[model samples]
Target: MNIDPHKLTPRARNALSRAGLLGQSTRVYELVQSGEICYLSNIGTKTYRELCRYFGVRCDGKYPARRFKPVNAVYLKQCIHYLRGHGYTVIEPSQSHNQ
Candidate 1:
């Protein structure tokens, strides 16, 4: 079943866009093929799990109700490098995580 990006929440679509995974390059394939959604800049695990559920993607994890925080800046930097190698034009965030 092909999941349409338009069917997902605006936040989810934007999340995929930020990760360079929207459009023809949506990693929905990767999600289904690899069973993993690589961490993106602004997307958190909760949003991710929600997106997964909407798309019927099977990922291994537990999602208990709790406070949701933003993605860690350090982790996003790590993902930036990995995504760049995949032909993604990822911009390094200007705001320092230190502050």
Candidate 2:
């Protein structure tokens, strides 16, 4: 399956944006390069887990609730990248990425 680069779904974009991931293209690129953000294979889009790993947040699986907090744009980008890398393609707002 081929993915059209021109169109990205609203849901996909929103997921990234709400997580503080979307913004000026250059800033996004820079954040990605600094290892401040990463793509996650499990969570679909840029997720808090990636950021946690980046920030070295300790977790013993005792508190799942505390796992997500202080989420930022950098983490969201990682989620998007993660989804894309795992054979998921962003098509349109109404359509889901094919894995």
| Local accuracy by lDDT, each model | 0.57, 0.39
| Candidate 1: C-alpha lDDT | 0.57
What candidate 2 gets wrong by more than 4 Å, as runs, is: 1-12, 39-99
lDDT of 2 by residue, 1-99 (tens): 222223435443454455455544454344334433333222232343333343345433433322432245566456556656654443222223222
TM-scores of all candidate predictions against the true structure: 0.51, 0.26
Let me know the TM-score candidate 2 reaches against the reference structure: 0.26
Error of 1 at 57 (Å): 1.7
> Which numbered prediction scores highest in TM-score against the true structure?
1
Best by lDDT: 1
Question: Which digits, one per residue and each the tens of the lDDT, describe model 1 over residues 32-94?
Answer: 334335333465566667676776666465632112222676765666677667765544655
